[model samples]
Target: MRADVAFVNGAIWTGDPGRPWARSLCVTYGRVAALDDDRECAAAHETVDLGGRTVVPGFNDAHHHLALRGRRLATLDVGHAAAPTRDRLLGLVAHKARELAPDEWVRGGGFDQNRIGGFPTREELDAAGGGRPVLLSHVSEHIAVASTAALRAAGIADLRRPPDIPGGRIVLGADGAATGLLLENAKKWFDATLKPHRIDELVGFLDTASRTALAEGITSITDPGVGGLDGIGMGRADLHGYLTARERGSLGVRVTAMPYITTTHALAGLEPGVDGWGLDLGLRTGFGDEFLRLGAVKVLSDGSLIGRTSALHEPYCAHAPGEEPGRGMLAFDPERLAETLGLLHRSGWQLAVHAIGDRAVDLAVGHVEEAQRRHPRHDARHRIEHCGIASPEAVQRIARAGIVPVPQGRFLWELGDGFLDALGEQRSRSVYRMKSFLDAGVVLPGSSDTPVVDAHPMKGIHAMVNRRTAQGRLIGPQERLTVEQAVRAYTHGSAYAAGEEGIKGRIVPGLLADLAVLDADPFAVDPRDLADIAVVATVVGGRVVHGADALA
Candidate 1:
């Protein structure tokens, strides 16, 4: 049979071990038809010369929040790049508030109170908001700052004192007044009374996100919180967004979703109908087709390291006088987590729990172990997202349980400075234990955890090989991986994490034709310049999705 497309004259680093490298590839009907020297490719209808560029399997972000990222693109970006200082952040919010009518909400994110020195206050937000309800999320997403108007709107306006609850926090000032800081589940307060986005709005967000992912050469991504809708407007879920995007042909890349658990500890159904978002019928993980599918059930066991809320085994090092040293915080009653895991696992749903701190890691490990012991599923490839601050023993234990530790390689480059300042050198260097996970027989998958950081796979690769922070300081020299290992983690390892290794992640015959062409070879580039290597072209399903016009 004649090939549909012949990608010729390129240096391809096929992820498949048998055909590790190839000079050309052939694709027919969206599947890889040949590795090299396929005579049928000569009769192909289309022939594109790759100009001898370096090619690798397309990137797969094993864990990401594309919907949220898409929405953030339209929100006020107070990220380090946009508003680097406290004054600039408030100025942006105030400027945006001037454009809106009174009582309108000023919603935005990417403000790092750590970089701003401390949590922002309502007084500051009020100065720019003009009676508007302002809600600004931290860079970590685990924390947020709500203005007085927002607080009053949420029915917690009196600052002299605050309501206390389990698994959440409300930061208070010296006089016991609310400081506009909300942590963990308390961040939900600012989300009250907002209307959920229409299905069309969701489709727009998905399109924006998919375009960005394609430009970055990411062919696949798994959303960690699909149906949870914890922070969606209107307290309702946009569960139909994925299906709508797919139906409209706007979902440019493959997507896998893990339905997040609700406060009732019940899972959302596979389909959304008239009755609430929860289906209760019969749909576990591993549902759906190739473009849109179900992945593991996602659960966030603890907060984030940057937010200083990931339940840790020890006290945090960064602190001032009259302040709580603050280790971290964990969620879900143990019984609740175990019971939920038991039900999901027994129903054949794979699990993906977010565990950032060592303590949270222990809880995740124990729960998985207990659940597996109670009802064993031999090939269940449950995963722990972030696996952020694991110890040596924890890595070994995770490996023994056959759990893939999906880590964002970009964290070291982006958040390494804060990590070092808060945890000291020894502890900070040990976080994300990439090499150790591999050494301990674990499949250490790589991802971007985007919206929290840049989603560029090359940036993540740079972090993997250099272990350098944003300030150019090296944190953990010992954990540095070679280019091949780093690339595999982002490609094959990520596919394995999503249980799609059989279909994607490789350039072998019969696999899908998803590949990325880089301007320079990673192995030949300087370690620091790894991220500088541009994606010249990106191909998915044997068709070029990005930079195709540039190809000859």
Candidate 2:
């Protein structure tokens, strides 16, 4: 049969050892035609030589934030510097201030209190910003540091809480004045009031993020939450943005968007199995031509770990005496969460709940299990996002419930020190326990949670295998997984979580042709050197999205 393109002279790891390696693959109409030999390719219409490079299935990031990633690129970056001190952060602010007009806001991201020693105050930010409104996000995206002008611009001159939202705190000084720190949803006040980006500009942002993900060997990503009354504004705008980018031939990676639960109310008016539900807008959890789709229903159960706002069973170790144990905030009351899950589960919509602390995880898992039992649906494939600080009991319950734990392995690499400090030794030791989850018979999918950390699968793999902190301390030596196990969690495990394992995870006949080419075999290298492996190329549906060079 005539083929559109064929890649030969390559070492392919198809994720299935039974048919582990292939010498060549044929492509037609943007799908895998066949895995064949040179003789088979000679019969094809076109052929290219790979020069014996290593090829594996394309990396699938189970968790990521596409819009935030693009915003980071255009904003000031304080997270890249090796040990960002006060002076270095100020330097970044000053540099950004010079580039913007006097009144324009200077937005920056990737600032961490752990790295910078402490949060920047309004006075400090004002000095660095040179009279412009400056707003810098914490590395976790759960907190922010804003100059006095920016706070004032958001109409937060005096410390006042919004009527309904709880668990969001605005740090105040001893003099009863507002500090620059905005925790949890309080950051949204400024984020929402900021100037909106044009549709063309937003599309450009998504294009840049997609190209970056492709270059890093990422072929697919699940954006957990988008759009709502919450400041993100991802609903119709994000839909149009992805559609525009795909039409312009600028999007190279597959995106599965999980719209926020607040938008679920809007979908209530629409009938189930509605044809072209966001499909014309380029959406479908299990649809599309594989480039973009809607994946799952995203719900937030609590706040963030770093912000000391995640709902937990025990008091935060860092909480001051007499302060309310710092038990954190719950995004939805138990009844509300259970009701939401019941509705989504009955509708056959897969759910991914963001539950960070052990208590929140337990609550979410229980709700899902109860929903499944009462509603009794098959192949629902519900997931607990973060699952970061679950106890052994919670882990067993999660496993028993048949829910997937989509943990961010990159957090171990970026926030290990802070985790240890806040959660103490015992709880911190179990953080990001990939092996424990697997051993308990729970499906564990690896993710980057990009914008929170660098979304490189290699780095995530290194953290999974090494489980070490930036200071080189072994945070959880017992929680480490082998190289092979880590790879499966990122690829096959993630596919399973998305209910696409049969068609996309393993490279075999009838599977999608999503693959990555590497400079070196990850299995052949020393465990400690896994992070050093370079991505030579990334191919999705037989198309070469990125490469070290064109095939010979």
Q: Pick the candidate with the highest lDDT.
A: 1
lDDT of 1: 0.83
TM-score of 1: 0.95
Every model's TM-score: 0.95, 0.93
Per-residue CA lDDT of candidate 1, range 10-89, in tens? 99999877768999988999998887765866888899899999999999998878887887887889998899889999
* TM-score of candidate 2 versus the correct structure, residues matched by position: 0.93
Model 2 ranges with Cα > 4 A deviation: 80-83, 157-164, 229-236, 266-287, 319-325, 548-550
- lDDT agreement of model 2 with the native: 0.79
Give lDDT tens digits, candidate 2, residues 375-418: 88776788999987888888888887888999988788788887
Deviating ranges (above 4 Å) for candidate 1: 231-237, 263-279
